[model samples]
Target: MNVLIIGGGGFIGSRLATEWLRQHPESKGKITLVDQAFLDIIKNNPGFECIAGDFSDPSLIDPLLEKKPELIFHLAAVVSGEAEKNFDLGMRVNLYGSQHLLEKCRQLAYCPKVVFASSCGIFGGDVNQVLTEETAPKPKSSYGTQKAMVDLLMNDFSRRGFVDARCLRLPTITVRPGKPNAATSSFLSSIIREPLNGKATSYPVAPSSPFWILSPKQVVRNFIHAAKLSAKDIGDDRTINLPGITVSVQEMIDSLEKVTHKGITDHISYEPDAFLQSIVLTWPPNFDTKKADALGFTADKNTTEIITNYIQEEHIQVPEK
Candidate 1:
């Protein structure tokens, strides 16, 4: 099937494009990747068409959909910390842009299966217990609020037969290959990424502070699984929290030590930023992923596996001291 990936230039988006192509090797249709920019790898692929533009612009989105992409993966967003710091930019891109895309999908002659990349950040503000499919979202950040809104739209749009959609509420994906972005949970990746690159990184929260985390690999798998799933499998609810393992900040560091050397632990330091900590502290550390698990979604085995997988996948070079 012809596929369209919004924000296909970003970390998760780019990886999903690659993995999707790998999984569908004998496919006949071109995979269209729409982003503000594109990676050379995707642009060079013969079976892929890379479109660089703003999805918020109806002009841009309309023409892209007219190309008739039957499967769409929506992974574009302003992210948590950036959205909180700049409300207008966040609303325009995260909220308004999402609505515009949905409207375009409604206008399409054929319904497309949309796999939206939502966030567990949607659940925050005194989330002290394990969050489940039934947990109500009490979003504290503008980013979280926007994601929760999109989750609603995904459900309603699917219910209305506008688009066959599945909103996967992804956790903080760790060991991202590139430099950190504005997302507050970025530090979670930074702690492992930088130390491996021989640079020091700081943890913005307490050592005991836990996070529901998936690896980049698992997140991509979830995206594909969501897209390939039948409407009957998802039922009426188009949104579900994807499976992830919860690990503390200290536990992540410990994993780094296990994967690399004990000396790698020295590369990490704690210097809590209250703003970051407040946003993080509000998110539930654990989740009951039984629903997602039963639905065929999966999580990482553990933190050590998370680290080792990153190293192998990224081909990271462990610096010699």
Candidate 2:
């Protein structure tokens, strides 16, 4: 019952950890987390084993693999914006780091189950059509290319019985419960999050720009579901385009106003960044998640429910109506 999360310090990774523990109280100390750094809340906790270090380094991952955790959630990666800016860093962490980990697993020969956090950005380049698992990757940015590479590697490893792997092509997760980081899609969260906190924010794309999105809660739920699936369930194709809803930027803003009060989006501006748009604009917003749906993965009901969920989860007091 040993479990390990690679990027345990990040927002989604941390949420997964909290929910994992809550669901499986008996697995208290058996779950471990490896990351470059951690929040005080996660680091100072006595119930979980938090390994604060760069997992890309063989020194870090080597010892971790030695323990042979039965279920490994590989959520670590350089974000889209950061990776697009620094190709070397992206290759190091996103590609090579993962390469070494898989090599170690193959050497160790435990064949543990691995659930990877891949992205929809992998469906770039003239992708106006709905994406499915059979859609070949046409990554335009360095970030997408690197993530796509890892997905291929994991699939190959699984085919060869080196590891039982599932790569979930995650959509842009909305309403993240923190300050936006370097992800090109951070604006998706910022437009909703910053204004909800009575702060100002701007989206770098047009109001009509379409995006595939899911809630943080649903993303974590799918990750857990992926881990429980038997090898026969996944069969040949290990990649699953996780369920998500398609909505335009204007639709999101409209929902924010609906969930809270009017003028919530008034705090948002129209400043645009071509750099961010270049990456996101190329992503295919529509998806046919027949595989994920059949495999028991869930999707968010709508943008309104997503915003409401965030408010409840973060305990954000809204303006009185």
Candidate 3:
């Protein structure tokens, strides 16, 4: 089972590569890790091959299609903030780039199973208190709009028997390691992750601001589960919302306090940024993932568990007294 991860060098993508390699070492198949950066980070791992190229390049798709990987996980994207900032780049990479891949798959005589990593931002607005697979998407950001559009295309392609595709609407993955990126929600992970590591963090949203979240570990598991799911199980929709736990900014701070045992909570101060607030306020706070649950997809049982597991797995050292 040859697997190709389009953005394999990224946080969630890299984790998925590692997990798949660890679990399927004996399987006679190659795992190709493709990303424009972080090739060296994944180079040392056995059974791993790296392809450094831009997914937006039309030329890149032909070579990848020639490889004929049996499984493809399309995770490459410009992310939320960058997408909103660079509209043309966002459309080129997030929307058209995905279409390029799907077109290649459609041209193939033997189609592969494609697992697209979509975002919950597609739901949009605070009024929709609980999002479900049935909810009509109303994306507010270019990034969200692009993901939602690709999701519809995936369904249409699947119905046409071009490929076995499943779109997983991932929540805001929190407690991510490493320095922050362009995502507006990066602060959600940074506030807890950075402070726990004895670093300062800023809260860009109000303490009462609430949003749905999933840990990196849960996100990886959800991706693998999506890949393993049968097309018959997914039906004609071909998209499902992954489960997540919803909590407020204050709740996250309190959880950090409990785990770190330091009044690190004091290190956090709310100074709401209108730009980020506008984007965040439009995101759904919670979801009704009954369909996902029934389909055997799951997230962290609780927010506390999500935080603790991240601290443990990433080996982020606790602050000293």
Tens digit per residue, CA lDDT, model 3, 1-321 = 889999999998999998888888853248887888764657777678877889779787678778888899999999898999899999999999999899989998897999999999887865556788888899989999999999999999999999999999988999888899999788998888888878778988878888889989988988888888899888899889988888998888888888767567667777778888778789988788988999998888777887889889987788875
- Model 2, 200: alpha-carbon shift in Å? 1.1
- What is the alpha-carbon lDDT for the whole of candidate 3? 0.86
Model 2: residues >4 Å from true position, as ranges? none
Best by lDDT: 2
Poorest lDDT segment (10 consecutive residues) of candidate 3: 20-29
Question: Once model 2 is optimally superposed onto the true structure by TM-score, how far is the C-alpha of residue 75 displaced, in angstroms?
Answer: 0.4
Q: Estimate each model's TM-score.
A: 0.97, 0.98, 0.97
For model 2, residues 81-126, the per-residue Cα lDDT tens digits are 9998988999999999999989988886578999999999898876
Q: After superposition, how far is residue 111 of candidate 2 from its true place, in Å?
A: 1.1
Clashes of 1: 0
Lowest summed lDDT window (length 10), candidate 1: 25-34
- Pitting candidate 1 against candidate 3, the one with the higher lDDT is 1
